[model samples]
Target: MKFADIGLSDELLRAIDESGYNEATPIQAGVIPSVLMMRDIIGIAQTGTGKTASFVLPMIDILAHGRARALMPRSLILAPTRELAAQVAENFEKYGKYHKLSMALLIGGVQMGDQVKALEKGVDVLIATPGRLMDLFERGKILLTGCNLLVIDEADRMLDMGFIPDIENICTKLPATRQTLLFSATMPAPIKRLADKFLSNPKTIEVARPASRNENIEQFLVKTSERGKRDTLRSLIEAEDIKTAIIFCNRKTTVRELAKSLQRYGYKAGEIQGDMDQSSRTAELDRFKAGTINILVASDVAARGLDVKGVSHVFNFDAPWHPDDYVHRIGRTGRAGAQGRAFTLVTPSDDEAIDNIQKLTGYKIPVHGGGAPAVDVAQPDRDEAEAEPRRGRSARGGRGKAAAKAEKAPARPAPVAEARPAKPREDRKPRNDRKPAPRHDDLDGPDDGWNGPMPGFLSVGFDT
Candidate 1:
């Protein structure tokens, strides 16, 4: 159904139209009406299912009449990560443009003074990470009792990040009767327990099974040794003609290394990991979205709620540690019902992880023998996958300047015969029976010759 049918304001509809969305996604359709009716909600959907707009769109209308009071935001939305919080803030800006709703984003790595100032002036909406929000709350900079609308986005991620206690604390601080909406990709037992304790007779909406694979994405697992992951990824990139992709590594160092390696091999690659400050991470994301870089090598921190358009491929450089992470990693692509492809590089040791991922998602990803990259055919990398991929230049039969140089550069001149051969061992005397050099005391008294044990000078000082 259309967004208008969901009872959104004309201003919101205009904003939606301007953003080129006419039809409401299933989650938006299902959750928006319930949210508008002031009902608490528990929304269960996989990542990239338009969960942000599901709440943001309706809240604009719900919040239009409220004037925020000092130190008390009218509404609160909690995100697990700074990036997700920022994304939600951006959505508020996009959808709330017609309404003059003031919003403040509270996240770490940014100056608290600015956030405090925003809170002092009051805001219609406060989008925040739990840690930052709790910090401000304890500092007496912000109050939650007056906030009527609460959204907990990516609840499972919050649980995974050990934010549930903070979440529970924030919940206790908020007015008990206030409306709360909790959205999550998967409902682990702990998350379910949190929901049971917090949400009050909420309207339950499940558009898709938790951790279920998106049918729009074609998934594959490529079997390779640990060391062959990079080459396998390169081969897949060549074979699949990946236009834009995010490569997921298990560790922050791996993220940095993979991005650098891809760049060295002539791909326009960038990295975002937890090690980076929030600003740097945001900047890298901006670069990726702006197409300044076509390939983003990232950690699971970017696996959830990072929405970039038209990403055609996702490569998992390492299998995710958590079964739920696999869902979010691939969810970065095949977004908004767009058909996409994902390839997971599976090593022998990843058997259990892969099994868990498939079991969690309730589907087996097809196996790709490294995409059968044609030895004689090579596809040119586009945008940041630039120059020619290393595989294409070498084994894949693509001749570029680098390849030409490789062909033209002469092989090493035959090693010069080790300067002078091992001078014959034959010239060496064996020490097996050689007597110790004669002591001065044992030698004939003062031999006159130069070869004497004591050259005459040694004996001459003592006895001559």
Candidate 2:
């Protein structure tokens, strides 16, 4: 369905067209109408499904006529990360171009003065991260009472980051009669309870199954040793002839190191991780998006809600620790119905993590080489391969010379012993006839025979 068919205003439709989108994505088609109707919504769609616009498009029209009061935003959008909040703010700017909807972004890692000033000026839409928003609220820099529309974007991510309590606090501060919209790629029990507690009779719209893999994405597992991951990644990148790619690492340190490694290998690569300052991160991301860097190494911070178009491939340099992250990390590519490939560099230690990802996605990812079996089912073979050496070492007691000798030496037969005769008891001397043993004191006395200091052997012959 087109944006026009979703009952968006002409101004909003014009903005959508200018942004080069006519047909609404499944999430947008299912969600925009309910949002426009002022009903609460529960949008469950995987990443890269245009869920951002599902609410942003309708929200522009809803807040078009409202005038925001001082220190209070008309609508509140709570994103899990600074990048996601910034992305939502960008969406408002791109799609709300024709409308006079004021917007403000509240996130950490930047000066708060501008954000405070924006809040004082009253924004029609407020895009904020939970941490920064909560901090500002505590300082009386912002108010939530005027917010009639609340969007909890990436609820599952918020849960993962331990932001659910802050979200709950923000919800209570908002008007009790507010219309709340909760969106998540995968709804865990906690996210479900959050929606149950906050949203009022929300229309649950799921464009796809929770945590479902995008069909446009071709996912493969590249089995390699832990030390060989980088070489495998480089080989795959060259083999695939990747135009642009995002390499995900499980650690921020790994992200920085991998990016440097890629650059040293003559690839244009950039790094983004939680440790980097906001400005630096934005700069790196901008470089990646602008083609200054064709490969981006990132932590999970960029796994969700990062919309970089034309990402030709995704490489899991480290298989994600969380199963849900596997979905989002690969989702960086294959966005907007574009065909893309994702390769996970799986080491032996990542077996359980990869298994969890397969189970969560409900299908085993194929090995990079098509003829080989999938990684999930091939785990036993990997285990056996690893155990084979251990079993050999156990049987041989290691490869030492002694073990070799033990393996080669023949067993000796038991030797026969000669029988010995026992002495007759009557032939032995009587106990009374034996002389008393010399004492050490007697031997060391002044009258002792030729002794300045008794020899050590003589001392041993005497009893104490």
Candidate 3:
């Protein structure tokens, strides 16, 4: 449906048109009307389905006529990460440009002074991460009593980051009569409980099945050894027709290392991870969106709520530990009704992780090279068996060469041993009267005298 059919104001429709979107996405179409009517909402849709605009557009129109009081915001949007909060704030700016709605961003990795100042001046919309918002609230820098609309974006992510308690605390601080909206890619048990407790008889709108894969994305699992992952990834990047891509790693260190490796290989790559400051992360994301870097290596921080358009592919450098993450990571591509591809490098150790993803998504991902999955434990045994004959042949050749060299050399005299019986203790010499044993080094030449027959074990022979 078009934005005009969603009952948005003429000014908001104009902004939407200017933003090059006439029709509303599924989530947006299902949500904007409920939000405009001041009804509670529980929206479940995968990432990149325009979930941000569903609430942002309606909230702008709802707050356009309200007067924001000092230390209090007319609407509150709680995001899981600093990047996601900033993205939501950007959406507000982009879609609310035609209106005079004031906005304030409260997130970590930056000074709280500016945020406090913004609160003192009042804001129509306040976008924040749970931690930073809680920090400011504890210091009395902000107030939630005046907020009548509360949106908990990325609810499942909040649960994963252990921010549910903070969200509940924030909810208690707000007016009980407020209209709350909870949006997530999947409605897990905890997220469902959160919505049940906070939202009052909310209209649950699920555009697609929870954790469903986008049909526009062609997903493949690339089998690779742990040591061969980088080489395989480079080969894929070079072989595929990529416009832009995001490579996801489980750890921030991996993200940094992968990004550096890609750059060394002459690919325009950048990284964004939790260790980086907010400004640095924002700069890296800006570089990615502006095409300064065609590939972005990132941690789970960018797995959700990052809206970069025209991403042609997504490469899972490390299979995500959580099944939900696989969905979100791949969802980075195939966005906005665009066709894209996703390749996940699965090592032997990632069997469990890949299995969990397939189970969650209810479909097995096709193998990249058209063979069985790569997590076979017996492969090493087969490799060792194939190498055994070569090892045996090498050993035989070495022995033959040694035997030939020995045959060419002159034979040395064989030493003999006497078969004398043990002497009686009385006939033994005293310790002080005993002579020193002859040292082998004392003799200038090999002994020519034979004491007795040579021992059979002392003879050397080769395998003929």
Candidate 4:
């Protein structure tokens, strides 16, 4: 159905039209109505399912009449990462352009003074990451008591990043009677518990099974050694003809390393992690979106809430610890009604991890063995894998054949059996020259079975 069918304001409908989204995604269709009714909601859907608009549209309609007080927001949206918060803020601008709803973003890596100034100007909508929100609240820069609409987006990722505590803290500061909306791609027990704690009796909306991937994405897994992961990534970028893509790494360090490796290979690649300044990160993302940089190597921080268009591919250089993250990572592509592809490099040890990812996505990632990659095929480093240091060099020393032979000798030519086989056992005096071994009973207890019935003589005498 179209946005109008969901009873959105004309302004929002026009904004949706301008954005080129006439039909609402199943998630938006399911969620908007319940939200309009002012009922709390729990929305579970995969990424790229148009979840941001599901709540944003309804929020703009509800918040249209409210006037926010200085340093006090009328509605609050908490995201797990800065990119997502910024994305939400952009949505507010896009969908709320006709309405005079003011919004401010409170996220780290950005200028706090500007955010503070925005908060001072009074905001009808506030989008923030958990950490920065807490900092502002603690420092008296923003107040939550006036917030009437609460949204916890990407709840599963929040739990992954340990933001649940800050989320709970923010919840306590907000009005308990507020409308609460929680959305996630996957729901583990912890996320469920957090939802149960925050959301009142709520309308549950799920357009698809949790942790499932979009059919628009064609997924593949390439088995490669750790030494070849970078080469494979480079080749995948070149072979896939990736116009733009986000390369996911498990660690920030790996992200930097991979980004450097990509740059070294003459690819327009940049890195984004938690450490970079906000301007640098924003510039890199803008370059990516503007097509100046075709590749972005990032940690899980970029896994969610990033809405870059035309991401033709997603590369997972390291297997994510949570399979749910795999879904979010690939969701970056295959968006905006476009077909996208995702490639993952797997090592022998990642078999279980890759299996878990498949279990989460509801389909096995097709295995692509060495051949022309659907993307460019970069030659693998034949000696790299063997060159890296092995984990915990064996205490026994290197096991090369030469080393083994040097450490052992052909059974020392067994001395020829003495020609005097006539020697009898008696003639061979007691071979064991050591003292006689103690008897079993002497070492343990008396052989007599009845000894346990009475106190031992040694015990009675010692007592006396």
Scored by lDDT, the top model is 3
**Per-residue lDDT over 1-464 for candidate 2, one digit per residue giving the tens place of the 0 to 100 score:** 97788898999888888888899899999999999899999999999999998999889888889688899899999998889999998999998889988999989999999999998988999999999999999998988888999999989999999999999988889999999999999999999999889889999999899988789999998887764566677778878979999999989878877787788789999999999999999998899889999999999999999999999999998988899999988998999999999999887798999989989999889888873422333122222333446566654555544554666789778699897897988878988998455455543533346544333444456558
User: Going through the candidates in order, what is the number of backbone clashes in each?
Assistant: 1, 0, 0, 4
The candidate 2 region of ten consecutive residues with least summed lDDT is: 373-382
Candidate 4, pairs of clashing residues: 238-376, 239-375, 239-376, 240-375
In model 2, the clashing pairs are: none
RMSD of 3: 11.1
**Candidate scoring better on lDDT of 2 and 3:** 3
Off by over 4 Å in 4: 369-464
Per-residue lDDT tens digits for candidate 1, residues 362-450, read 99878875454222222223322353464455535766656656667898677677576677887777797664566665444544553
Worst 10 residues of 3 by lDDT: 376-385
Weakest 10 consecutive residues of candidate 4 by summed lDDT? 450-459
TM-score of each: 0.82, 0.81, 0.81, 0.80
On residues 1-464, what C-alpha lDDT tens digit does candidate 4 reach at each position? 97778899888888889988889889899999999999999999889889999999999999888688999899989998888988898999998898998988888987689999999999999999889988888898888888889999999898888988888888888887989999998889998898788888988898889977688998888877765676776666656676888889999878886787677678899989988888888888888888898889998889997998889999888988888889899999999679999888888888888888887777867777544344332334533333333634453664443454655756556578758657776756664875344433432354356333333343344534
Candidate 3 backbone overlaps, count: 0
> Which residue runs does candidate 2 get wrong by more than 4 Å?
371-464
With a 3 Å backbone cut-off (N, CA, C), the pairs that clash in candidate 3 are none
